[model samples]
Target: MDIISCLPGHVIDRILSYLPIREAVRTSVLSKIWKNKWYTLPNLVFDKHGVSDVASEDSLVDKNKIVKIVDHVLLIHSGPINMFKFTEDDVIGEILVTDMDRWILHLTGRSIKELVLEFLTGEEEEEYYKYKIPWCLFSCQSLHRLTLQWCWLNPPKVFEGFRNLRSLDLNLVTVAQDAFENIVRDTSIVLKNISSRKGN
Candidate 1:
């Protein structure tokens, strides 16, 4: 009926892909055609502290809301998620770790190419713990680029995967020397570039 609405579904999906995850998701309510477009988006971002300047109470509410939104997106997303980015906060606590494991496991089922996971820094409470990058990541053969900031790395003894990985960046991550070497040894064939906070 409308010129904009008549555009090809792929074209529409491409256009919607550029917008922020939240804004893109909102477009779903515009009509039935656009209702499920968000689910097919290949890229999804969840920045937990989007409203940092807001009051303390409001920020907590927004953070919790973000966690719930992430749950829904990862669960219902129907298309292959090429990239996934999320910011973790300590306020969410131990529950967030379980949720992240589940999320990563879900992504492994698809052909994910790029993964960026950053944890919020500054609070002393959150300082006590760092979310360990799941061992399952080593088995993700589709992963080409990976980045982790303020997270922990514990490579498993049986680690053997990421043959497609080309770039890896680990910033401010606490990792054992031998464990780190193990990761490099496994991916040395295809991994060309790697930078970690501990080293130059």
Candidate 2:
């Protein structure tokens, strides 16, 4: 048996967290001891380099593959997801929103601590198409840090705030004056850092 495998399970999980998510999952093939160890990995990152399968000479990513990969991982994930980061610039119009909504719905009850959702597009088209984040995201009280880029933020009228959220980073996001006021003015939240901007 390897010396590293003998280390405590928490130590192993910590070690795996440092590796790229793809490499971390590949560790399951190393041996029986490592099998399924990644299922409990708290941090999940889905980005171009990590999950993309370039489909053609044009260098476009296969969106369907990415969606399937996310679905499979979340379906089998066994423990609370402390952090989930998803960055995809090639997400097609409305399809991406559906998948994102479902994923957020799944993560809500899992006590996710940090959430990052970024979708990049051509600057000209960006203003016309901003992802409206799923309403469930605003209800996630476990979120400690939230970063959203190139999306529209319109929380429900009854929404209060993320009670545990300490940091909020909004880049190129559009929120109505009333909605923005409601989010920042909540007494229940003591945000340590709040950054917002209107993109050109």
User: For this target, which candidate reaches the highest TM-score against the unseen true structure?
Assistant: 2
Model 1: lDDT to the true structure? 0.72
Q: Which regions of candidate 2 are displaced past 4 Å?
A: 52-61, 186-200
lDDT of 2 by residue, 17-110 (tens): 8887778888987777788999998999998767644444442236666777889899989988999999976534666678888999999979
- Model 2 clash tally, residue pairs: 0
Residue pairs with clashing backbones, model 1: none
What does candidate 1's lDDT look like per residue over 17-48, in tens digits? 77877778778877778888888899887774
Assess every candidate by TM-score: 0.82, 0.86
Candidate 2 local lDDT, residue 43: 91
Worst 10 residues of 1 by lDDT: 191-200
User: In model 1, where do residues sit more than 4 Å from their true spots?
Assistant: 48-60, 89-92, 122-127, 186-200
